[model samples]
Each structure stands twice: as structure tokens, then as C-alpha cells.
Target: MTAEFTKRDYSLVGLDSKLAEEKGLANAEWYASEIPRKRMKELIQRRNGPAIRDTAIWFILLIASGTAGYMLWGSWWAILPFMIYGVLYGSASDSRWHECSHRTAFRTKWMNDVVYEIASFMVMRESVPWRWSHTRHHTDTIIVGRDPEIPAPRPPDLLGIAMSLFSLKTGPGEILKVLLHCTGRLTAAEETYIPGEEQHKVYRNARIWVLIHALVIAVAIGSGSILPLMYIGLPSFYGAWEQLLCGLTQHIGLAEDVLDHRLNCRTVYMNPISRFLYWEMNYHVEHHMFPMVPYHNLAKLHEELKHDMPVPYSGFWEVYREIIPALFRQVKDPRYYVKRQLPGSARPAMPGPAAAMMTE
Candidate 1:
């Protein structure tokens, strides 16, 4: 795969060459330019300032929620809210980790590190590894080898749903499955596949996240209830599931080809309720084109850009109405890449749900 597209090596896997040609790109600049002057700052924010107040709020909320969790651990349903808080507090704060990783979370470089470190701690998602993979993905959303988010094509089926649910590959699995692959140590599953220096960073921040989880497990065990892992894991898993499904619904049905953002990824015009849950991830195409824009700014861009969020079906509901039952059938069956490139063309072969989805 690396043999071709050697210049950027991004298009080697499967990204088509048309990613940069989409018409929706015009409004992204508007969202990026909202800060008033620096255009580059919109895409690559230089400020790494601390979001102290925001982090503090999430921290306090989680701590309080966990305390509630501790008290209500034994109740079958009591743990629900705690698990929700666990993933969401971390996920919400994840916005900051993302912001910082992009170097825009805080105003100072150190602040970027600080907020990232803290968000990393809360979420058990490390910074360095994520930073490395994300930087590449941020730059290229659909380039197969380059975009760490696009997965090799899978057979869309019940098994496909499971693989999609658990995979850490790029594409539809970005939020849930992908996070699992990157957050932990290099397991046997990843030992052979763990990326190289070009993909990983100077620091393998996996240790930081591991330690955080280790501490959580230790405390949970010490508390004498083996159920807290469920308390933490369930919600996190559910949140991961919700996030993953949301991601799949975003672009699964589009006639995707590598390197072609216009055809592969479509923008979604989100309703107020959907936006509340995702903070605007539903408008994926726009977000991908101009990632520096905050969630708050995505809708504004949508309004100004005039691009509609394409959901294949009617909306988020319709897409997911078909995906959930599918996951139950696919958890044990994993998808792999058969072919990733075209022989002579510059376009890359996108490994999406090619086999299963075609039949599907």
C-alpha cells in the first residue's frame, strides 16, 4: 500500500483524489474565519490555553456522580447514571482533549498539554498516541492509509455490525472501536498491527491511560464490589456504542470511494435534539473539512454554507434503525482488508462496507 501514493502515502490505502474538491468547503472557511483574522488558526489553532473552568465543572460533576455511584453501586439500575456520567464527563471533557491535541484547547502550549493530560486522565484516553493518529486523521479524513479513521471495507451484516462496534480501525468506528484499539497497551490483537513512529508519537501515552484505569479498577475492587467495573464500563461502552452508531449513520450509505470527500462523506443538517447529544458530530462532512471549528460553530457554518447533512435515509433515526440489530450479529466476526489500492489510478480503494454493504 505504501508503495504508491508515496509522496503523502495517504492515498495509498483507499482515499480517492476528490476529497479536496467538494463545494461545501466554502462555508468551512467562514467558520474558521469567525475568530476575525488568522485563517490558518482556524484549521490549526495555535492557542493551547487551559479550559480550567470547563474542566473543573466536568471534574466536579464526575466526582459527585461517582460518589452517588459508590452509594448506589448495589442497585441494579443505580449504576446507570454513574456509568453515563463516567463516559460523558470524560467524553464532554474529550472536547477539550481534542481541542488541546489540535493545540487550540488552551491559549498556551503548556496549557494544551495540561488540559490534554487531565482529559486523558479522566477518560483513560492517552494524549501522545491519540495525538499522533489524530493529527494524521485530522489532515486527511478519507485517505485510507493516511486517515486513521477510514477502515478497510467490511461485509455489512450482523457480524459487520459487531466488528464495526468493536473495531478500532478508521472510518465508522472512530469513536468507539478505534478508541479501544488505541487506548490500551499493544495487545496481541494490535501487536502485529501497532503503527510505526510515523503514526505513533514520542510518548506512548498509553501508560497514562492504563494507570488511570488501573487506579479505577483498584479502587472499585477495594470497595469490595466487583460491579463497579460495570458501573464504569457499561456506560462507557454504551456511550461508545451510541457514538459509534452515530458515526456509522453519518456516512455509511453514501457511495464512498477513497480520497473523495464529496462522495464519501456527507454533511448532516442536525436537529436541535441530535446536536445536544453529539454537540454537532452529525454534521460530519463540514466538521471534517474544517475541524478547527468548535461544535458551537458547526451549526453556524451549516447555516451559512447551505450544505445539507445527508443521512442516506431520512435522518439519524433512520440510519440507526437499521444498524443496532446488525451489531448483535457481528461482534465476533471481524472485518479485514482484502485490497486497498487501484493498480494504476491515483485513486485509493476505500475499505468501507464494500462487500457486505453492496449486497446490503
Candidate 2:
């Protein structure tokens, strides 16, 4: 049950990184489901309409809920409005930041940039560092040393995962990272993925974020109330549960170091509300395989690819039913993973030490 032999270096600049490259796991071409060129083109085609409409609705909800929360302050009724506001501010923004980072959310480049910046602040991810970090994530997927974004590295920090549910762990760390960046410094690991040319942008963004946070603190001090922070600086921590809930299902229990996303990523059906907030990222395998497909078109793409892919989890409940236990098992057995089984029409799961067939 011990994980001693399976302990891995999860660092981007560590020995395992070189190992991954030597093993051809670094930026390697991956297995992808086949689709006709015409259909693939249609799926990758971006349109401004869906993103524009969704963004409008998102802003309207934020304004409405935030106004209600502000008006109802000093009363017990305020909690309800603020809860809605927090979800919109913290939870929904996570997906917005993600999609806009890919520039697939909106057809217009400037439009995506604007939302990307706004959502980045809301999610407390410094725009520049995270953009490069996420690029590494897509390139490496779940490869232990190469992927900078592996959420649940083996022998997973169970307490840390619990703290992240409310952003208790990640929020302060991100803020501290920004503070470090504001001093015109970059961590050695950050420098590995983020180019030297982009380093200045990271420092500049950190300073802006620190200034905005300082302004929020100043407003609360001047008013002799914490109401300002409730609207801005605090929601990212208080409303982070939804973000973690949707995000954990992406690859927590899946095989690592596999070339096929079908073996590592998850595709779960979600309710309409969760889908909206997560921006259809529950179709995570599809997104990882064909990142150019827009959020609005993931469902259609899922349909087209399902015949050639492993069976997707039916819903969040189904996904977690397996993930929760698998994580607990991994705490003692780091080699354990939920190996996916491909359909008869599809190719076998990629070869790896973690390879096995998981039945539905």
C-alpha cells in the first residue's frame, strides 16, 4: 500500500521533466478521434454570438445579484444575494478565464482579451503566468513532470484539496505569487514555461492586481465596513467551491503520462447551470484533444466523437462516485488510477504502466 517506489517529481524543472522528454512524453503527438475534415472545420469555427450572449447574461446576473446583496446588507436576507454574486464572480469567471485564454470564446481577438483579463482578476490567476502555465498543461496533459497544472499529484495532499474547496489554500498562494511578481521576480519553475519576453507582462500584471486590491482595502477602511471586499476581493475565496467541484473531475483519478486524452481526461454530462458556469468544459477529453473547438460547440463535437471514444461519465454524481474512492485509494497506492475502456469502434487506450480497463 505504500507509495515509496511511485513517488514522482512533479516539478516542471526537475529530473522527471528530462525523463519525460527522453521518453517522448513531452509535447508528444497524441491519439485523437477521427472526424471528417468538413465536420472538424465546422467544430473549430468560432463565432462571436454565443460568447457575446453568454457574457451579457453573466454580467446581468452579476449586476443584479451584487445590487441585491449590497441593498440587503446588514440583514440576514443579504446572504442569499451574496451567495449568487459570489458564484458569478468566483465560479463562473474560472471558466470564462479558461475559454478566453484559448481565444475560442469570441471570434474577435480584442473581445477575448478583455474578458480574459477581467476573468483572470476575478479568478485571482495572474493573466500572463497562467496563460503560459495553461499552455504547458495542454501540451503535457497529465504527464507528471511536464504538466504544470496537475491538481492531484499522487499521495495527494488531502488536506490541501479540502482547503482548495473554499480557495483557502490556492487563493493566498496566488496572491503571494502576485506579490512576488510585483517585486520583478519570477520563480525558477515559472521561468521554465513563461518566456523571458513575457516576464515583464507578468510583473506588470502583478502590480496592477496589487494596486486594485489595495484600492479595495482602502475603500473598506474609508467606509469603516467590509462591504467593498464582499463585492470584489473576497468572493474569489468564498465562492470557489463550484470551481473546484467542476475542475476536480477533469483528471483527478485518471491515468497520467498517457498520450491519449481518452485515458486521462473525463467527459461528464452536467446540468444546464453547471454547464453554463463551467462553459462546457465537462467535455474535457474533447477539449484536450481538439482545443480549437469552441465551448458552445462541445456538445456537437462530443456527439460526433462519442462513437470513437471511451464512454463518458453520465453526470457529476457518476464521475465523483468513482473519483472520491479512487483518490482515497491513491493516498496509499499512488500507482492506482481509473483506467478508461474504449468502445469497440475506437482504438485501445494508450500503452502505459497505468493501463487497464475500467468498466461502466
Give TM-scores for every candidate, taking all chains together and pairing residue i with residue i: 0.59, 0.96
How far residue 336's Cα lies from its native spot in candidate 1, in Å, is: 17
Candidate 1 per-residue lDDT over residues 237-355, each given as its tens digit? 43444445455654453433233343455455556644444556666656665666655556555554333322224476655554444433333332211121122422333233322
Assess the local accuracy of residue 225 in candidate 1 as a C-alpha lDDT between 0 and 100. 66
Candidate 1 overall lDDT versus native: 0.47
Write one digit per residue (lDDT tens) for candidate 2, span 228-257: 999998999898999999999999988888
Q: lDDT of all the models against the reference?
A: 0.47, 0.91
Clashes of each: 30, 0
Q: 282 in model 2: Cα distance from truth in Å?
A: 0.7
Off by over 4 Å in 1: 1-57, 89-96, 105-111, 121-125, 163-204, 227-235, 258-260, 271-277, 307-314, 321-360
